[model samples]
Target: MSRTEATGIRTVLSERLLQFAADRALQTREFERRVAALPADSPARASMGATLSAAKAWEAGLLWVAWRLQPRSRIGA
Candidate 1:
């Protein structure tokens, strides 16, 4: 109910959101590497590509939610 508690909760949520975004980015990078190392005709490469696309989509969604949750004053800066 207190302003301090509300800010604390927001901070924690922001940190967790950032962490999730970072983790997804890392996973996407790894998937790209795996896809690159696979043969051109490999079915697994196609699967990895799809996985990477999904990871990027998830990251974008998280970023959008985080942006919406941020304070108005902090949104543009």
Candidate 2:
């Protein structure tokens, strides 16, 4: 994915996260904890996970999208 694509994904994920947070039932800490519980490599991270499936899906997609857009740069090469 190009940088622009990554930006778009990030925007989407951020917006979704914000929406989840905005919900009266979801506390900030609870929302964050659910996000943290998702596997680092899991697509759910970008979405809701453990907390709420729908939210996880959206968040996971974002993370997946970002992973795609990330540049291949060697570290300490």
Best by lDDT: 1
Per-residue lDDT value at 73 in model 1: 56
Q: Rate the local accuracy (lDDT) of all candidates.
A: 0.80, 0.60
Model 1: how far residue 75 lies from native, Å: 13
Error of 2 at 16 (Å): 14
The deviation in Å at residue 52 for candidate 1 is 1.3
Model 2's TM-score against the true structure? 0.33
Q: State how far residue 33 of model 2 sits from its true place (Å).
A: 7.6
Quote each prediction's TM-score. 0.76, 0.33
Model 1 residue 18 CA deviation (Å) reads 0.4
TM-score of 1: 0.76
